[model samples]
Target: MRKTFTRTILSISFLALMLTASNGYAQQNNTNDEGAQHLVKWNVAALLLKNYSFQYEQAIGRKTSLALGLRFMPKSSMPFSSVLKNAIDDDQTWNSIKDFKTGNFSITPEFRYYFGESVFQGFYVAPFLRYARYNADLPFHYEYQQNATTTVKDKMDFNGGVDTFTGGVMIGAQWSLGKSISLDLWIAGPNYGFASGNISGKKTLNSMEQDELRKALDEDFKDLPLVKTKYTVDGNGAKIDFDGPWAGLRSGLSIGYRF
Candidate 1:
């Protein structure tokens, strides 16, 4: 009787081990069939602004994911015309605005919450952070006494840029075209940040010339509501330091492929 009981117990143990192994194998196979869960996207609106932007997204859970983007604006694509047009007033000084140039690069990281059933599709809310570095030549005007009686006026080139850090919340929608393609649209969003840089003129100025330039800037930019200005006199020339609140609008459209 004892020998018969031992044989039955061994058979049951062997059957249970086989069933567990089969279930584990089936789970592994299912995951392999699902494939990679990531997408790569290009921003079309960025190209229109003469910038190249690329984004990558990966799924972390059923309703949450993370996205990272990189944007580049080469020196050749300097002088973003649209931005300059909006920032500058078309007054007498408008004609003085020349030699406008900018070189910038930025990185953005966003955390998203999807409302729809899929990870990268449907309406979503994302809070994003961006860091950027830039170099630019802004426009300025100055005047000096040509002689004992006559005064002459000319434009001065302000050469410098800023490093900026900002964060904001974005709400947008995305749709899938087929199994492999998707479109992303940014509706509207607000961003706020700070910038710090030096603005130095192309040529060195004497004490009298620096005073004249300061007076000119005060009058010309008094009505402009964007930046708070400070001036520092250096050995080469006077440097205008800008430290203030920055705000702007954000929107874009992108197409992506899933892999």
Candidate 2:
């Protein structure tokens, strides 16, 4: 999987560079340019989703530029609580997520080519590479058989994180907003890649309890689209390991200062 991901990234990056090199015809249409050589931008729309992001872009030539962006999300309650609860519709799943907390960090680098002969002007296509990490904590719930006829329900606290890398393209438009300011509208950008992660907890359990907990985990997440899952249960504790496809989107309004 690692090799595959690396290859995908190299392919996308090479394609972007090739396009930039082959765009010699655009050099003759440079009169449409009306922007500065450097820009600093903030995607304020991300504030609504609790994700703060910023970007710095530099014009490299008559119609191409390079940009890098960083995003950080402080630990907070998981967004869309009601929507997720209603979607799952399971008491056990609900119990685990009622107090769920999460945070994230990511970095993205992109190559942009403007259709109107300048950076941060008119329409543009951007091919980007993103690496993201997601941190989460929740209580895993399960049932344990105590004696001949007694059953106890309990929960184990689990915390862990996942990492992902993906490459994709975006199309957007930017317009100069006064002498030094610019407005960028990310029309739409969708990305796809692979992800793997582990979330585990410590709880001494007998063989019956371990089996029951394994079954509980399966029953809880069976509906999701995970490609594969591996559970480890031993004397001290248990762990849940899984890997699958990861997909994401990029679309927001940004305010920028050009100089």
Candidate 3:
């Protein structure tokens, strides 16, 4: 009976020691994992374009992570003088056009799967979804006749905006520089989506003038690769309703830092 009690006590003590050791090992692993998990990065390429973009990533498992990005570009305009000089040269017909203005904000979320050993480094594939809103204004010239003998020319502005939702897959490689800095290169990816928007012209004209201007625009834009377009006469000018497939190129060299 005494031998049986001693054996029981030894078994209980051994089991307690084994449980304690296992818990300690688990706590150490948890500490190591917490150190490896959180990362925040800013896209330097977006900054170079005068836009603010930031990315945050958190590891959910050994080979998977969730990333979120935000980008915003305040109202900005680019002059067309340089492009016109190269495209039209000394053609006076296109010289009156001024500049193009654009602005946008977007949010993108991606689920990333890293094939390498580390979380945010090496080759990865991500399926991402993006939501964006943008505004733009493009200026062009049109001709009208003020009287039977006088022909007048005026500059008109096409102003519009659109909201877009897109989903695509991205394959990219990320390399680390020392411990905290990294570089990301997106190879090539295809994204397809849809956008619906309204484009309005900025001109005050009579009904006959509006009809003539709409007709002129119809003739001018007939060759454009738009999916669908509808024109409506507004108070002074005209508004265009556009519904189309939106395609854009997505590739950039971004410098980042890991935290």
Candidate 4:
């Protein structure tokens, strides 16, 4: 799981750099400066992965264009919820079965303007204002045996979900790739921290409930060591702020029909 997460981050960063390098080429080489003749092109692609997949893009113009993207993944993607449920459902791992599946999604749309002479070929920097949305739910199935009677039983299920939004500044570079395509790379973080809010299908677990669960597990299962899990969730009901520069990175190729 750690390896998978690390690979995802690395892949995103590498793609972003390649796109920016391509855009830099277009800026330094293109001699044509006629603003009226410059053209804008759009490209889009879909991502298919284990738990998270989505579509993203790159737009090229004379000096500015837009960046829009979206992604979907499940919080239960890594199986943390299963561990949590284990503490509540049974004392042993195989004694009781707990299953939860969640869905996560985000959308980003922004206006980005280049800094150099050309849009596609210029070495440009863009300051963007963007928004994101996240939603998730964990449906659980539990089975256990009564302590005193040794009778076994199972519960129907439980569900949990949350929603949030964030606004921030993103700085990126656009490097030109030949005459028709541009490579893009960027990093972004929130200004005043991130704000987020969410609703769960089942009763939500507060911070205290979660902490108690953790403490109980540590005391009861000290012999069985497990990695600690930490989460950084910020945002109000509609909007929030965040900390970090490389929130995400994206890359793609585009075709243009210049007039």
Candidate 5:
């Protein structure tokens, strides 16, 4: 709920900037621009990864623009299966992670400064803030004592999501195709941020089962970067808590239309 409220406020703030830029202020600079002061672009690079993303840019100054972008991917099979197996040294761990299904949604608001003769054409630098959320599901395995002389090995279904906020800078170049056509290349972007999440399974468990499940999590998720894995267990269910620093990179090839 807090995440939703934060995003809502950002959306409204962006809309206010849009209104101001598109009104008298935009016309005041129309003669100086003599070119398109607005552009909408589709990120083709993201499509290659089965993600859909789009951006809207509005010129707010002679050499500056403000843009808002959104990226989305529906929950499905994890990507790059081969890379996953090769990257992790543990075959058992790889086997377990191989079945994870994931998806994400993100929003980025950018402020750009163009160093070219025109606003939408030439090299530019942009500082941006991004808010992203990711959802995932995995089958977690464990062993528990079911009877005096018997041991049960089983897997429980786990599902949950995370929310993160980050800030970054990107450098890129844009070319005007003709009257209203454009091409934008996002060369490099790196961001750092904090993250928190809860992943859990909904099922009744005995004390012994819960204890064993907690031990399994400690072993399986120990490698998660920059964070300590936390486990919560009860008769109601089991949960994994995540809180840590996150780093990310962004790059894209986009096609745009100016108006």
Candidate 6:
């Protein structure tokens, strides 16, 4: 975990430095006598565009440009589920199920390779890469109790962890609405998926040890009665798979400056 976190931070910082260095060069070139002839631009607002368009002008420019910005999604969600339902309910016979909710935050670094000055951004497609994380906590608690019934009562409480990986292709156009503002609007996805969850519970049970009571409860516990058991349960695991389009959106506006 520590290594992963460290590497992610380092990658984001390195991308940021490159963006800054490129901005310095673009600004220097913009001051030349033939301003319109220069192909460089440095504007923070244009950097913030959430979408990109694939047009001849924006595509004709340089193919290699580094974009460093934070992908802000007031919300990043992942599907979550757990197998430890028995830990939460006191009566396993009459089980109740609960769904888990997930969320996370990540720093997104983008590199764009324009195809050249052509209708389809010089190329038929632009491939992009993104690294994201999904971290969340799910809590469950329940208690069952009975007296004189030889009936059993159980209660459990737990929490778990979830992680994810997002990767996909974005189809877009670059609309140069003047030099300061540009719009890149198109849908992106085929988002990849990876996640895991954990749950732990502190359990306590009390009930009659009578044979009659035990028999009534069920055959699963017929052998033991007038029983009292206390246990600690914990689980941690992970998973990986491919997801459909829009399965998870890391989409957001990125405000960038040219120089």
**TM-score leader:** 2
Q: After superposition, how far is residue 223 of candidate 4 from its true place, in Å?
A: 22
Global lDDT scores for all candidate models: 0.73, 0.80, 0.71, 0.43, 0.82, 0.36
Top candidate (lDDT):
5
Ranking by lDDT: 5, 2, 1, 3, 4, 6
Residue 17 deviation, candidate 6, in Å? 36
Tens digit of per-residue lDDT, candidate 2, span 70-135: 999998877788788889977877877878888999999999999974566667999999999988
Off by over 4 Å in 3: 1-34, 79-84, 90-97, 144-149
Find the number of clashing residue pairs for candidate 1: 0
User: lDDT value for candidate 2?
Assistant: 0.80
Clashes of each: 0, 0, 0, 25, 0, 30
Give the C-alpha lDDT of model 5: 0.82
TM-score of each: 0.76, 0.79, 0.76, 0.45, 0.78, 0.40
| Least well predicted 10-residue stretch by lDDT in candidate 4 | 232-241
Q: What C-alpha RMSD separates each model from the true structure?
A: 19.1, 9.6, 18.3, 9.9, 11.4, 16.1
Question: Can you tell me which runs of candidate 6 are displaced by over 4 Å?
Answer: 1-61, 72-102, 115-124, 141-158, 196-259
Better of 1 and 5 by TM-score: 5
Spell out the clash pairs found in candidate 5. none
* Candidate 1, superposed: residue stretches over 4 Å from native: 1-36, 76-92, 144-149, 222-226
Q: Kindly list the per-residue Cα lDDT of model 5 for residues 21-128, writing each as its tens digit.
A: 443343355433365789999999897777999999999988899999999999887777778788899755665688888899999999999887657756799999
lDDT of 1: 0.73
Better of 2 and 6 by lDDT: 2
| Tens digits of lDDT, candidate 4, 1-259 | 9999999999977976766565455445652343424444443332232233232334456566655555556444434545566556454433323343455665656666666664444344443333444443333223333367664432222233333444455555545445444344444334222334433222344554344433433453344222122232212111112223223343333343333
